[model samples]
Target: MIWHSTGRSEDGVMCHPVDGESWQKFDVDYPNFSSEPRNIRLGLAGDGFNPFGNMCNPHSTWSVVLTTYNLPPWLCMKESSFMLALLIPGPKAPGKDIDVFLRPLVEELKFLWQSGIRIKDTATNTFFMMKAMLLWTINDFPARSSLSGWSGQGYRACPTCNEDTPSYRAVNKVVYIGHRRFLDADDPLRMSFKFNGQPETRPTPRHFTNEDIQEQLGRLILRKPGKHPNTLKENMDRQGFELNRSKRSIFFELEYWSSLQLKHNIDLMHVEKNVGESLLGTSMMNDKSKDTSKAREDLKNLNIRRNQWLQKRVYQIEKENSPEFHKELSALSMGSQMDVYTYTACIINGVRFMVLSRDAQRKTQNSGVLTVCENGEKYYGQLEEIMEVQYPYDYSTVIFRCKWFDTGDIPDDNFISIDTEKEAYQDDQLIYASQAKQVFYIREPVNHRRNQNNNPRCVVEHVNHQNIWDLPSDNARVQNAYSDSVQDVDNVEVENVDIVQKDSSPGARLFIEFSHTFKAMLT
Candidate 1:
């Protein structure tokens, strides 16, 4: 385990947390602590969840977990290795009071960092004083504010950007903008008029350093725990919006906190979920979308995107006033239209089937197959066209025209292999759409790839069509059928038993009869 933790992979890929630069930096800074590989490196994570499973209860529970990064990457993340350091039960999240609950854990970590603990190394059969470090804290956005004592909201909400965070009021919410500032100076988007109708000539915001953060945090008044959130807002407004630091984070109490490269890491899962939901909602223009009527109004107020204003644009539609439009509307209302509808695809028995013309254009074919069972004989074919015949009383029925494969020379095998180039039953082309079943054809691999015409045989595979809202039946029929020449082996075995018993001696005949009876019972 020690070798695995300290070694690199064959291709030099990072396979464990020890390979990270932060670990190396810590090791270089604290040579005495890095001397023993057995010393554990831990990460702290906390989140609030509902224990009752009923959201209406409004009760919340926060679990503080510690992960040991000394083990192999595969084993380190497993639940078995996780240490539940603390569980804070509540009718509401602890918020700023979380530091009060974290005090004991912080003191223990400080003791481990200074005095250390003596333990027996099971692998080495020796005792050594082991020390550990609190590498970082992981939490979602809201929990980050509680854990780090930093405001995750307001004009200067971003911790990395500090006072230079870009934001503006858009209708009812704060909209963060100026992402183009991070792009290359020569990039076309820097001069694009589509966004805010102005070029983004501003440079990217500067990242805040640890000393700068400490200086800014020292000037702020720490709000007492359990106070109304509005009170914190009032205090911040009084102090001014230039600073987002609420208080010195409780983590700073640790001796090595300032020395660590990253003290707080935002959980990626929550960020991904939020970004994905916003993208999908906006693209689909659903109720969850941010692109609302008021948003367009705001854009118009900004004197940008004149074409996308809420005002309707007039379009010329000469057909709407044409005489033919009234005639078509009357026919549709009366259900007396004489026109026949030709469709490229249709669904039958919960299976989608498409005509050959439409299916040919696709890379993967799903609807071209046509299979039918008539007079106890199964026929394989490809769909040619789908037509709907309408009657005067709004009655209609669908018909399918297909081209069938030749079955006369098909080999006697378990799989139905047919010559793709040959056609059979040409005169018998049309069938009621209800009789058709969906299927697909797979061409057999051959040595001559460049000459597909030389390898014309294709194996038939049937598709199972089932209702969406129904459970699958235990006794579903198998689709594969055996050729007529391959007789049932069970019947052949029974005939052999009859022939053997007739020529056997009396004792042998009695044994044969008993065996036959046993076989029949087993069947």
Candidate 2:
């Protein structure tokens, strides 16, 4: 029980699974409301997924899911915990009619927010009044408008910065170019991109931010949607119920989550999918793939310029003179001429360690060692996995894929993410140490079967010892437990794991014997 201390009594905890410093921002930002552990923060997510494997069925399935950030790292992710708010079956996409489908869930949420329900915390074995509040809605670009009560297309598309989105007349239809307003006048991003070689004419009212249009407020009022400035007053004339009656979503009334600038964010994977598909459609010369997208005369000019740039980088200039070439050169570690890969230390079994990529050669194995949790070690458990993009890495990443070390700690903040994979702790995942301390990976597993149809992931087999005291302390100790050469499911060389000491002591040892256990605990 001493070694398994949950740190509930400690004042010095940071990234807590339930109520650590992770939720401090939301609480600190709002001084009017006192921070309490029982108040739940959550996010509503909805996506139209096809239940049928084949498109021949031709039906869309839209399901609303709510995730709670009130659970701990261990049990926060169990599928049984995920609250299925609603299920909307559709022969066609819900479009604007989606509000009718979301009413019941919203009403239930309204009741829960106003009058909390009695709930028991199994982890601490206590009963409490559990009041929940919606944080924001999560969805892909297509589903953003449907769930968040906002238009996702055209100039009025941006949920946070309404109508400030710059636009240019493309053909006959008005096409919104990009978020020209999101950039500063002198920002490098302002020059990074341009529409048809012309810099976007900056948005009017030059010094404006998302706070101008979107705000978290107490009242959710019905209004005619779109770019009109006087939308609230316009709703007075239009009096009806259901979809026709109100264009504004019931979500605006939550009162707690009203402050977020962008409530509805399109999933990045969908953006990547669109880009990849478009690039694929553009790459091939054959006519068979011609239907992938409409042919555009403008694309020809774009391709011509891209080709010219590629040629200049490849042939026209010396490699020493190119900035991009120099960047690649800088990627190589000093003396280790081969490219450098990075390793971010992840806390595993309360010990700070990192799994190097399988492709890491002995020479470049220790190339770019980034030791987090070395001094300021972040807590790891079923929760706290992050996937980020880094240079020079195709599959290189840090997986927070480790176990809950029942170190003496308890989160004082009632913050946990319920949107987690059940087997998150079991598999190897890449992660970044972010302040969020969110329980689940933002995306799916690295090698999920659905993601890579050709190469199905082999089921991972883990050897669970009865107690942490019995777990391996050294490579030899680990090899003793496994019959078939201490290998992961992927059959990589995991035997070379290096468990460096996290203690800041000038000369500390790895896994010191229990001889000093009593003294250490007393200290």
Candidate 3:
């Protein structure tokens, strides 16, 4: 058959060959392939699923999917371009027996490698040969080890790197991987660890050659013994066809196939699934179920994040503060229960409580515009949204804190620089999880202090029944209150009486007191 002659031997062009295999031609194709034959650039993918969509079924089947990178992007993923390579019908997991199912594909691949299929070159009006090359394999995490002939667990768990996972045995011979640390003799901060009283040292990573790995299999038989043709075992062995698929996976003795690197990619979907499974299993297996510390260290390699409630951003009361304040803050629930207590002085249930408000600013009657000094650190930071936190020491007692951002994107129109009384407070989604016990007050220089504490802005007032105009004019009360500073005082009076009825008493009392000096001038 006439093949795609990349470099014409008749034209005196040097066509390099190694082990009886042509090299330069791989990059060139027949004229039928537009200009030259497209490089196979093939990706082999396999996944097992039930065709019946019966979850209750115990049987399983795997399908080998083949797609070529040579195709245009739009057509690459089309069903028409996806060629089926093999189907491994199964009632149970194939395990190493997978080689049995792969025999057909292997035989076909060998034939294609040595004697390619013949087809007429439409442009040249002549028959030429063409071959497809296996470039890479793509499989989920479970299949990674089987396909790559590499082990992904134990001390040498990592398939791609020589990072030896440091493992130790506990009371019952249970192996647990520990945190990896770089040995630094010069750095005093690096806590030194010892195993069996011997200082632990970083291991020098190991490297293995493909041939070295293949030899470790001892012997391999790629085909079924029962189906072995009358051909002698000695003959197949001599020709190296008797090797297991894992060893044969090196594609030994094949002209161009021997050198082609068959890369097996890790499918993220499966990796994520496995990681989640491992965490769930570990959690449920424990008596505490949510054993935060031990489980976190045991599977630290996964770098799994703690649940949202345990994350760092959740504000917590500082233990440095008095234990009573911290204890009180810790006991608060999501909503008002009893009353949450803060040290800042405020009125709740007609009783006073203490709380802290640094650089408190009064809200404008028209707009809630407040300002405070920037003490070295930001007061609120990015959490501009406001939330009211109810103290649990008494009923109707509450303090305001900075609400955390929502899981979804905060609409710019909702959270951005809009000055509105209605939008100042956050919508319901901003509520903190139960464990976020410490109040996270807003500290941003440009913070929107929402309608909290019944105060418009930072202006605070005590509700009293007494009226200012009703105070004694003799200034006796004011003089008695600040006797050391003032010799006299003035009784506050209403210049214009708009006498309003209070509970049909036809009178309301108000009191205002001033120093003698100011009182004498005003009167």
Candidate 4:
């Protein structure tokens, strides 16, 4: 058979093999271009025996060529590369015979390219990729009989099945190519071998079947096993894999297969480690090397101290400002009852004051008096009585009183009426009638005390007189008066007044007083 290089250089010299060697060279003959450059071609004889044994002599054939030239700048810096395809002459068989063999080789090349192997760098040169493709074809299939799995005479039966099946079946059977197929006694292609150069009559060895070969290959390719590093057993301890211990053989099979794959790539270590860490990181399992009991005890103590601190704060507030304390306590109680309390606060001026409750239940008991001091002075009050004045609206109205004014004196007459027409009397003209009588008049001296003793007394006419009754001489009367009048009025006023009590308890009474000066400040 003859081998030829297809593409031409510009020169008239044919771009052919230089000699019957592993390499060849040719020159490019440019007709009009000023630069004349030679291109190189390299070839490799593919592996596998040619059935005819008539293709270019395998050992002595030309495989590659490099031509001499004033190399281009790009080529001068580095050695040029080329892809080599070994051309095998087609058999004298009828119809599409060559194509049938070529297709499978091409498919295998494509598969190799897809598996993370870069065949070429487009930026550098396309030659490397082409070379990879050519390498795959040659390595995968050198000749038609290499694929057809038949001798030159096309009379050899399949080695595995020993049947006179189609050539295609013979190729597939002996080569162990394609997906595996399970066997059954009823199958037309049941295991059988050739005997005495003809189709065999008996079943072939089960081990020679396609299914058995594939199963063996699968086991060989696995990446994990009991004894392997990062093995299935180690992975189970680190991560974990569920398996039925009852099916020991099946379990071993899976692990063996997985281990084979692991050996081929250690990059899967990260994935294994992550999975293992996640499984082993659960909180339920305590580290045997650590003091787990001590840690738990410490957590318990911390919680106890936190609860004590909260109770102390509540007590202090209740003692200091009973009204505010009660309001907060009430709010907490209400929130607890409703089971919706999340946050509670009392803000004074722009500063936020917070009372924290652990949960809804704790909030119900939150109300109590809180005493707070400003400067050196201590003041006590209830939370509700403390007015909440917001910014911009009541900012200017916020005030605290440091001192108070003292007013002294009581009016003598409980009841008094004044007439506008009465003239003012001089001090000297006024006279005292009798010290014993609790009566006084304001009038001209001439008309004073006219009906009674003829002593002059000031008679003020058309003026209402206030009667002064003597105090009750006994405690019984006082008690009676208090029970009937004093108690009713005081109780009514206390109830109606918008006063905030300091104590949070329902029955506890605590009062907080803001002085009149403080009230004025609010306005």
Candidate 5:
């Protein structure tokens, strides 16, 4: 069961003992052991006692050759177990290297297997149970002791040292400690700490400087545009809303105009034509009135007259005193006042005409003619006399006049004027008629008693002679019509007249006569 080295022989083979027997030149093979057998030869000699004689008497020498066998499994297993125990947990053995420890453990495992000891049975029955118990003690003891301080509170073990502590406080402490250590190692000015917590010198972390914090905060506050994918569509939609409002205004204006047209039933084309004609006429009148030669002559004549009157008045007033004259003159002098002139024109049918005029000097003649063409008929009058000027400056005006005549009587004239100036002119020409043929004088006032309360009454002068004709049923008539017929045509032939004959009875005769009279009056 034991292995002992005997000696090395001249043949250069190692001799060892096994099973308490000496082996020499023996073929020894052990599984997981030596691969070759070592051999040794022993010599013995016997001789008769020939005292002090290197005598010629000789004795025979004997060579003993022995064979050895492998040790038993039980014996080898026990030896291996003892070796493993000594290698693993024993004190440092003399003359043993790292290989010696490892090799013994390996040999023990192999011997245990050869002795029919299963590795799982040995681990569970003995070695593993003991190791597990030892590990449990080492892991649980510190954890149990630290529990009193950590009672009723959550705790996290330190990642580096595996010691129980409050998580955030532990992290902060470690960070500061690590920072201090790192600084002390690099900086000669900073004194390193011993077991005490106080620092002998100040230490700072360059990486955790104020500049780095500021840079990081600046990046957080000022973000790049379009970086967040989720916000891109929302931003785009907001921009689109702004764009749509501008585009929608045009559609709104169009709708407003259409509604206005529908409510007023205005013929836009007719309105435009009338406006153009009136503008043209006004321009013509302006050109004609701009003849400075006539205005200059009138101004000259007035100035001469005024100067003469002033000179005469001055001479008479001189009797009072020169001072009196000066005082009176100075009192009479007034500062210059700003004056403005505005002219407005409107078109009627194909003709252009002026509808309004405001002059600063109050000297400009207001008796300008306005010509209106309606339904292929021409009429002329002063705008001031015929229609009221509403907002003359804005050119918004209206004229109320009758559309048809019931009788031959002259209509009443209503005067409406908007005097915006500070001083009113009594001598201002109220109305003027151009193309005298189209002008008609109203000799009698119009009657409004029939529909006075119900209908709006307006007085319109007849611009056409044919419009003056009245039906026989109307009793009132102008008596001196022939005197004003100087411009009337004689024996004028008229078309579109119809005559009806009646029965020659008394009542029928009366009706026939009445009918004839009515026709004549209408004509």
Candidate 6:
């Protein structure tokens, strides 16, 4: 592990925290402190777990652990290297009250940073003042808020984006977007019409400096320790909205805390797990997925992703393809005397759909449809109408009428090009609502446009829907998403972007025993 101090492994891989910018910045700022590799550089990690493993009857037991980055990367994260600094027992998590329990540790850290303890170096047979600095805190997003005094929810939830976090109040939940702004300045995606129609020329949000954060803290009234912060509404007051800080974190008491380039780290495990679950739920189109009917509606409200809308449609198949499909039409079989009701919108398989007319009225085109044939062929169309037909026993089934765009050619290159000028299935245009999956279309950019007409040929994008496939368990889906993110980071896959691991560990035992006062306060 001593070789790790050289900053690069034998294979040229950066295998230690010593090679990172954060650690380098720390050294440049406090050269004296970093002069000795033996001088302790520590990280504090805290997380709550269910000891019982029974989620139904859960207990919040939090472990605060400290690790040193002085060791080589491989040995640093081993369980044996973990030093259990404090165990917070809880029938409930401490929340903001966690500061009360953390007071003893903060005081010790302050003492170590201010005045040093004398210790003999075993290898050199020389005595020196041993001192330590807490480089950063490590925790999941929720625990980070508790430890860092930053709220992890609402509009400014993302610490990196801060005030510039792009948020949309969806029909159901608040969602964050605008990752495209992080792209390169000349990236084509910045000017692409696929997302939200308008070009995203907004430069990346300004990174908050240490001075910026300190200025915010100067104006904030730190909340009392052990008391919960205000509700989201109350916190939206002028001061709270301006400065998202809930309290001045106890860590800021350390003299060197503000100078460190990175003050807190979001644990990769939690972030990856969350991102993975979101991907699986979406791919499987299940209830656990964030891509719900409300999500589609959110797209509509934002005037983006217009193709994702499930349109009210008349089901009509091409007579040449499904020749008998016209005979199955309820419209032809049932006379006008039969009661048929029309609806603008309906929910099917957790996917929300709107009629083409309704889609036009709303100015969001969601009426696209994609259907797969038994022979593996695919058809693309736009829904025209939605109808509910009454049966002899008063049973009812909804049907859709659609106008399918004509596919010009099955290209040798395997590209699908649809001609909006030509309609495909004219005579045979009817399908049971259950048989349809929503789809949307995007035209090739002007330079790449494959058609000559004003209405260019379009490409189809499937609207992710529920019940598409039998999905893996929650844990497995998360693992897949997490693994995918790690493997494909160079591709800029955003679903659940992985955070680079910054903290390292090695063997250590340094406990901050709780004082009687702290124990009494816990009780």
Q: For candidate 3, what is the lDDT?
A: 0.40
- Report how far residue 266 has shifted in candidate 4, in Å: 41
Q: How accurate locally, in lDDT, is each candidate?
A: 0.67, 0.45, 0.40, 0.27, 0.26, 0.66
Where does model 4 exceed 4 Å of error?
A: 1-82, 85-142, 146-154, 157-162, 166-523
- lDDT-better candidate, 3 vs 6: 6
Name model 6 segments beyond 4 Å from true.
Answer: 1-4, 7-12, 228-238, 309-523
The digit string of per-residue lDDT tens for model 5 on 299-407 reads: 2332322222343456567776665575323222211112211123222221223333321223443223323345433333333322222121222121212112222
- Best prediction by lDDT: 1
User: Comparing 2 and 3 by TM-score, which wins?
Assistant: 2
Compared with the true structure, model 4 gives a TM-score of 0.13
TM-scores, one per candidate: 0.56, 0.44, 0.40, 0.13, 0.13, 0.58
TM-score of model 1 relative to the true fold?
0.56
Per-residue lDDT of candidate 4, residues 141-236 (tens digit): 223223222222222232333232223223113222111234344553332211111222333333344354344334332233224554555343
Candidate 2 lDDT tens digits, 323-395: 4554332322111112222223333332333333431333322111122355665443432222222223122
Model 3 residue 367 CA deviation in Å = 60
* Cα-based lDDT at residue 471, candidate 1: 20
Worst lDDT 10-window in candidate 1: 511-520
